[model samples]
Target chain A: DQQVKQNSPSLSVQEGRISILNCDYTNSMFDYFLWYKKYPAEGPTFLISISSIKDKNEDGRFTVFLNKSAKHLSLHIVPSQPGDSAVYFCAASPSTLYNTDKLIFGTGTRLQVFP
Target chain B: DVKVTQSSRYLVKRTGEKVFLECVQDMDHENMFWYRQDPGLGLRLIYFSYDVKMKEKGDIPEGYSVSREKKERFSLILESASTNQTSMYLCASVRPDATGNYGYTFGSGTRLTVV
Candidate 1:
């Protein structure tokens, strides 16, 4: 069973515009969500994260919004740059005893920012 | 800065061969993880270790084993390699009991191909 899902396989945005990536989770136990950015031949790097207690968290150009009722979360990047083009993965952890902060990741969405 | 290093960036093996993927983290984090990433499937956890000599099986632990001989090193073992095992393998580390996320740091990944 896939606890987390990223429905969109790819996304494209123009430079200086906004890019939004979406994620959903079927597991209600999950309370922490994170987004990671990956470039070719490199491991994923942390971008931003949000706790379930808060509806939104912002970090400079990146922001994450969570909707617990809908089991949905999104990462928004404003003023997108060409360097931001890469695969973005959304991951979640339940923080429960059994889960132990183990991350369940989505399939990832490839973002292409056009210059 | 945390550095997670994988033994090999690429490896090729024949079917029925034994293979080992090694990972080391400099941060002395308590938790270490192994994952396989494939197209359309995202990242799937293979194994994780919470402490020295302690290990846990993850969602896709079948046909695999792990070793945590020391605090800084974790190894993934494939007793009998198969073509299906061809995929990109990643190792990550985090603090086991920390709530604020000592944040997961991932290795550059090892691409394995079994003929």
Candidate 2:
């Protein structure tokens, strides 16, 4: 079974609009959430992250919102540009003394920004 | 900037042959990981190491083995290549953190094709 899930396979948004990508997790112990952006043939690059203590974290045009109660998280990209088109992956990790520090990743959502 | 480098961008190997994929990180991080990416399945961890000569199995470690004799180098070995093993392999490195909120730096990835 998948511990982390990205329900949307693809998303499209107009340039200069807002793009929202959603993710969910079944593991309640996951306390740290992260988003990574990937291009074709390239490895994933870390974008942003949020801890369970905070409900939201923002960096420039990218914002990540975490809802621990719902086991859901969303990434919001404002003023979406064509350069932002890529696959977005959501990952989570548990915080514990014995934790291995391995991250569980979602299936990923492909976002396309149209001009 | 942190940099993780994979030895090969693409590799084609015959079935039943022994294959090796090498990765190196310049950041000197304590944690290194090997993962495979497949369509629909996303990224699945094969193995990871937190210290030299210490390794732990990840979610998918059936046909793969790893070596971390040194801090900066990690190697993934396939005892016998199989067609099903064809996928994009990624390497990542990160610093150990108790909060579990640290982001990982990933290499460009290696595309392996077993025929």
- Residues B1-115, model 1: lDDT tens digits: 9899999999999999999999999987888999999989999999998889999999999889999999999999999999999999999998765437524899999999999
Give lDDT tens digits, candidate 2, residues B1-115. 9999999999999999999999999987989999999988889999999989999999999999999999999999999999999999999998875655557899999999999
Deviation of model 2 at B5, angstroms: 0.6
| Cα misplacement distance, residue B79 of candidate 1 (Å) | 0.7
Clashing pairs in 2: none
- Scored by CA lDDT, what does every candidate get? 0.92, 0.93
Kindly list the per-residue Cα lDDT of model 1 for residues A14-40, writing each as its tens digit: 999999999999988888889999998
Docking class of predicted structure 2: medium
Residue A84, candidate 1: alpha-carbon lDDT? 98
TM-score of 1: 0.96
Q: For residues A9-47, could you state the per-residue lDDT of candidate 2 as single tens digits?
A: 999999999999999999998988899999999999999
Candidate 1 interface RMS: 3.1
